[model samples]
Target: MSDEDSRPVHIRRRGLDPADELLAAGPLTRVATGSGADAGSQWMATTHAVVRQVMGDHRRFSTRRRWDRRDEVGGEGVFRPRELVGNLMDYDPPEHTRLRQKLTPGFTLRKMRRLQPRIEQIVAERLDAMARAGSPADLVEFVADEVPGAVLCELVGVPRDDRAMFMQLCHGHLDASRSQRRRAAAGEAFSRYLLAMIARERKDPGEGLIGAVVAEYGDEATDEELRGFCVQVMLAGDDNISGMIGLGVLALLRHPEQIAAFRGDERTAQRAVDELIRYLTVTYAPTPRIAMEDVTIGDQVIRKGESVLCSLPAANRDPALVPDPDRLDVTREPVPHVAFGHGVHHCLGAALARLELCTVYTALWQRFPTLRLAEPAQENRFRLTTPAYGLTSLPVAW
Candidate 1:
């Protein structure tokens, strides 16, 4: 029931249970977004209903308007050459259609289920390593970053040994603290690194997603397009997956009873994963949208060319979405939440992410029944600078 009513949407205390100031000022109000003098205000879709309205109605609120189309080819905006922009977040309709069609098969239910066994093995391996390393292990380093990071690497055909480089690149690019030039360089470097793997996959479809895409499409898609697509999907699950794993463990340990419910059964743990995603809302703010034309959402009219932001945590935590909204109950029945977003722009890696979470929570806790925070929960650093919200390092002792 308590939401920040007066304070700005972007600023919040940086730790576990950070104070949410956006709700205090009231939901669905305009607030200045950045710290700079040139910072302009935009309407924040804070409630579950409104956020879905904007994301769902892609026609009215186009994500492409934020960038100029003049730099790219055709009407596809920056997505024309396709190497310039990340997947569907850039293009609309036919352009989005073209790219989404090619990538869809790689994320199919069959693919996820197939990946499940490998994911469990990865989880078990990391857990075994942690056990060998003894208690008081840095879960973020040993288990969290390692588990999903490796899965994503394998999925994209990146070598598991090279994870450190990509992890730095992924985290640095999403970081808001870094200069724009610095972030752009990191992103470009990430794409370039994937180019090598894509080239390799071209000659031999190596069972990874990049190889899978080449297998189906053949020469229909250019290397550049495939490279950009690979880069986007590779990083898609990078921070969010690892963040959820680390944060999920932290949340479960805090509520030990909930931990017991998720420790073994995959079916129950799968449902609990959705609840955890809703409760955490770790990706605090994703890309903002701009109105292609004047759009009326709820009682407010968002004018043409205006940017719209969605506060994921606020919307997911909205009382209207569920009773006792702020309480983190793993037993809550699944409701429509915008944690992975809604409609056309909904997360492509969502199914894969859920499978990863289910495996992590179940296999991880089963391995360490005595898992507890190495330091006080308040002492752990909250990684607020990046696009996603997660712990910088989670120190846990079993």
Candidate 2:
């Protein structure tokens, strides 16, 4: 069948279901197959086609302003919550290049290597806390949720006492069900907190990234800009890493043989992490991009100013790209996946995220050889309604 003729068939086959099942089923479905505002939206059903088109031709598809637009919608305006997080991730060309140049140095292999020992210490501390809390503890509530935020706080120079509050603020903004009033309050409070932290860093300066950014930029970086970068990095780093840890653990539990292979051989952890990222495609969908110019994606004509959402989950699972994509195989060879995204707006913290995932999976499985889900695998809650997909709670026992 022609591509156009197959679109409807694809849509009909993938019908709307919970977000978890949508993911568990595999990627590259017809967008109209799902419920939500995008349901039946022509642009939605063509997600897989559009992603292939975009990845194949980067010039026509841009990520600039995608996340910014989401922030505007989520924050309600540029003046409040949106202002608290920086625009580094949402800019194009020269500006993005400039910011990335300044920031990329810190995420280098040398820097990540230095952070490794500390990450292990932090992981052990968290696992110890979980052990103290006893069995059947929520994996998300303890290790997956807390470790990344704490690590981010240390990296950005947030006071140790304030890490919990910072995490809470991050969640409040990301949670769609949060009332406008609550978001506003959280935004304002976070802005004030960040501004204060930036001001203090300017005066005393520390060994962390915030101090380094301040030292390099000095007076050139305004309070708003510094605070924005901190908030953006913190949120981006914490949320994705946390979700991956929780989801990776769940994946291992579901596939016992894979888990055994991974734990029995240290070499398998890296490949397993890659496969989990590919299979889970945890971020779910890419931010909607507005066509800056008239663009032809595949056979479809996309008009200027129209919105296009790329479902990473679908793209990662495209049968054309990954053979037998539904089957989880830790032994799968290195294959390029868009879990961190594609194009200029790809995730800046990709290396750090991978490090954390490797650490979590390696440590968790090794520490608790008999680890298994405390609840029925099917009963576990997955975050299907959000822009990012993950579990709310991952109860486990050893």
Which one wins on lDDT? Answer: 1
Cα error, candidate 1, residue 125 (Å): 2.0
Model 1, residue 114: C-alpha shift (Å) = 1.6
- TM-score, every prediction: 0.89, 0.82
TM-score of 1: 0.89
Tens digits of per-residue lDDT for model 2, 1-398: 63323432322112112133333433223245445765654354223444756644445554555344544422333332456335564554565677766666556787778788888889999999998998878999989888898778777777778778887887786667888889778867877888888888889877677677777777766787677777778767777787778877887788788886556565677778888888777665555565667876556677765556666766667666678876788889857777787767777788788788888888887778888899987787765444455678899998
Ten residues in a row with the worst lDDT in model 1? 71-80
lDDT tens digits, residue span 1-398, model 1: 32333335554533434355654545578878666787778987788888888888877776664335463322433424444554567767767777777877788898888888888898999998888888788888888778877888767767767877977787677777789999889988877777777788889887778888889988776777777776677666777787788888888887888987676566778779999999887877666888877888767788877888888887887889989887888887899999898888899889999988888888877778788999987787666555567877988897
Estimate the overall C-alpha local distance difference test score of candidate 2. 0.69
- Cα misplacement distance, residue 397 of candidate 1 (Å): 1.6
Cα error, candidate 1, residue 98 (Å)? 1.5
